[model samples]
Target: MRRVRYYQYGGPEVLTVEDVDPPAPQAGQVLLRVEAVGVNFVDTRFRRGPGSGSIFERPLPGRPTGDVVGTITRVGPGGDARLIGRRVAALAEDAYADYAVAEAQWLAPVPENLGAGDASMLAMSAPVALRVLRSAPLRPGDTVLIHAAAGGVGHLAVQLAKLLGAGTVIGTARSARRLDFVRSVGADVAIDYSEPDWPDRVRAAAPGGVDVVLDAVGGPVLQASLDLLAPFGRAVVYGAATGKLEHVPVVSLFALRSVTGFNLTAWRRANPDEARREMDELTDLFAAGRLRATVHAGLPLTEAATAHQLIESRSHTGRVLLLPGGLGPGAA
Candidate 1:
């Protein structure tokens, strides 16, 4: 088996592809033949270490741990044989390999028509967006605001909010060019966050104030999101893309408003059932042609360093994928 591993925390150069014997699944686990691996911001963060979002607490046993989607090939003790040969997506670590182990419960069936790359996208972002929206208690007629609305999680979140009956969905992007794509994805209005008074513009677009706010660009953005929320509204803080530190005002909760933090990794651990449920919904949407993934670029597994560079550069749009078979000259 071949897997990408990095023993030290650094740049993309740290990731190396090496041949190793594939490990057999232990009890209650299933072996999956890798199809497509999802490259997330956290994956890059973990690879680069302390500079990016709390990379491993102290010293992880080894570097490189993230999500993947693959097909089941073998079932271990306490695992159901029915899972063998099933196409599924799972939130497992060390997915940038040809094979990985997954607990059956965490695996969600992939739709027959969907390809590996698409399944890989849904494996992480969709589930997280669904969980965050649901946790914020979105209801019909509620106005929702999402920051970084053109990125991986943001784009899907725009559509998910619409499907959940959210009204006047507003998204912010630093680039005006991406606003068109954001609106096409179901956001009723799109704003360029580069503007000085973007939050005020969001309020202007949504007269009643946003009912729920999903913000990944934290720091001052989090504070602005709180100001944009309606009375009794909830603000879900998922990521801190700004790299700016923040001190939350606990006293603000008295205004019948609430602020909560949600990480997909932590949420998945706490609510597997909820995660699976949302995944199922996402699959249905994909199959029905209601959900689409925006892939910025695809590089060969061996060229993982290039993918990391594109993501870190922030010049790319949507999620970047890795094809284990390697890339052609025309490959992005």
Candidate 2:
């Protein structure tokens, strides 16, 4: 088996690919032949250090923490052998390998309409967007704003908001190149956040004010989103992409507005049933052609460092997939 592991954490250069012997699956776990792996900012944060307060106090000895989409090849005791030959997307023990073990319950059946690349990308963001939309209580005719509207979760959140009946969707991009792409994903209004008064543009485009706000950037942008919300609007903060946390003003809620933060990790732990339910809904949407998976780039597994560099650049438009078997974009 081959895998990418960071002997020590610092930068992309810390990640190195190496060949190793495959390990046996544990109870309730399935060993999957890797197809595609999702490269996420959370993975980067974890790769950086313990400053982000990840669950793993110490790096898993030698393994990297990630997830993948693969076919079931073997099962352990109490696992479903019938799952063999199943095409599944899983959150694995260490997905950066050719064969990784995943708890049976953490795997989702892949839809025929979606391919391995898209399925792998959705392993994280799709469920996240669904959960955030549910938390926003998205309703018909409600105007909404999404920060970092071109990033993974933001892109999915935009489409999910539109599908859930948001009357108008506004998106913000720090660069001009991303503006059109943001609008193409169902954003009625796209603003240039690179400018100081971008929020003013959001207000101009949405008129009265936005009814719901999904923020991935958490610096001045989060505060600006709160200011753009209409009375009785809900603001949900999901990520701190800016790498800085901001203090919220409680008095702002007096205008019938509310502010809350959502961490998918906590949500998944608390409501596994509902989480699975939402993933099913997203799968159905994908099958119906109502939602599309945005894949910006795919790199060979041995080039894990390159994948990390691309993600850290913050220039890609979609999820980055890693090919564990040195497969290219054409891989199944």
- Mind sharing the TM-score for model 2? 0.92
**C-alpha lDDT of residue 3 in model 1:** 86
TM per model?
A: 0.90, 0.92
lDDT tens readout by residue for model 1, 13-70: 8888899888689897889887666677766766766666552333543335445667
lDDT of 1 at 100: 84
What is candidate 2's lDDT per residue for 1-332, written digit by digit as tens?
A: 89788778688888877888877788988888988888777677777776644432356444666658888999998777899999888776567888888888768888765776558645677888878877987889998888888877778888988888889888887667678889888888899887988988987887798899888778888888888889999999888766668889888788899987788778889998888788788888877878876777778888888888887887777677788766554343
lDDT of each: 0.78, 0.79
Candidate that would win on lDDT = 2
- After the best TM-score superposition of candidate 1, give how far the Cα of residue 271 lies from its true spot, in angstroms: 4.4
lDDT of 2 at 200: 81
In angstroms, give how far residue 105 of model 2 lies from its true place.
0.9
Displacement of residue 35 (Cα, Å) in model 2 is: 0.4
